[model samples]
Target: MVSSDDTYLSMRGGVSRGIRRMGGEEIYKESQDCRILNALSIGDVVVTSAGNLPANKIFHGTVIDWQLELFPSKKIIQKVVHDCLIKANHYGYKTIVFPLLGTGAGCLNKQIAWEIMLKQIIMDLSTIHQTLIEVVITLYGRETLSDLNWKFFINEMQAKWEIK
Candidate 1:
């Protein structure tokens, strides 16, 4: 997912901190039973019940192997996102939220990661005629938003998608 360690959903660090904050400590404890590590590998994904979080499920995706590279290949990122979306659709999820994949501890270039993520999402949405109702790409923290050039990203998306 967000370059997590063997701890399934540890309450200590990274994206898990946000997840733990929202879902509570009990959820993290519960998640340990899920064997999240076993499901993780580059390009692999696992879906778990979100417990107290305001979503039906949390899709954990591994877009990069941290031991190998800080920034993964664009093709790998696209495939991971595509597979996650496909799994969400299969699970009958109408709405899903995605973080900029590999932009966290993976140390990916934020702007490039955003661009790749947006491009892949746009392509997927165009190709897949399925149950997906909404796809929300969320950026946490002011720093992350700034680093990602949020305004430019929005403007570019508007231009590309012909949003009026």
Candidate 2:
């Protein structure tokens, strides 16, 4: 079983490269199948109905807002991460995978983002047992991997899990 860590980050290659570079203003068309909505402050969970995806539920956490341009602030990101954990905690989800929040089109600093993410996750896990749930942060493509040093994340994970 994949062990629980304060942060779980990985690097992998992407199947297809995006046409445009990340961090510019790009419009995301909302389909009838997929809708975006405002997130309530309570538990930092954004409630969205069933989307085209197979998952019974899709939680939309706003990492970036055009009008507000909140773009994965450390506080906002932490709240979002916390909400996911709370959902998993209450719903009994054993494992949930997450993507790098601010790397794609969010214009965030990679090293800083990793540090902030790990800090919040460690804080969240302090209240819960490790056996209950595990989260994996998935990285897709060389661009992401290049910016985010995989070794840093791995080291953070080791420290959090008490691995020698």
Give the TM-score of each candidate: 0.74, 0.59
State the lDDT of candidate 2 residue by residue for 76-163, as single tens digits: 6777777777766675667755555565656667677666776777778887654445666656565465676769777877897887
Tens-digit lDDT track of model 1 for 39-87: 4556666566676877777666665554555345687678778887798
Off by over 4 Å in 1: 1-12, 25-39, 66-71, 144-164
* Total clashing pairs for each candidate: 0, 0
Model 2 off-target regions past 4 Å? Answer: 1-44, 49-56, 129-131, 143-147, 150-164
Which candidate gets the maximum lDDT versus the true structure? 1
Residue-level lDDT for 57 in candidate 1: 72
> What do the candidate models score in CA lDDT, each in turn?
0.67, 0.49
What C-alpha lDDT does candidate 1 achieve relative to the native structure? 0.67
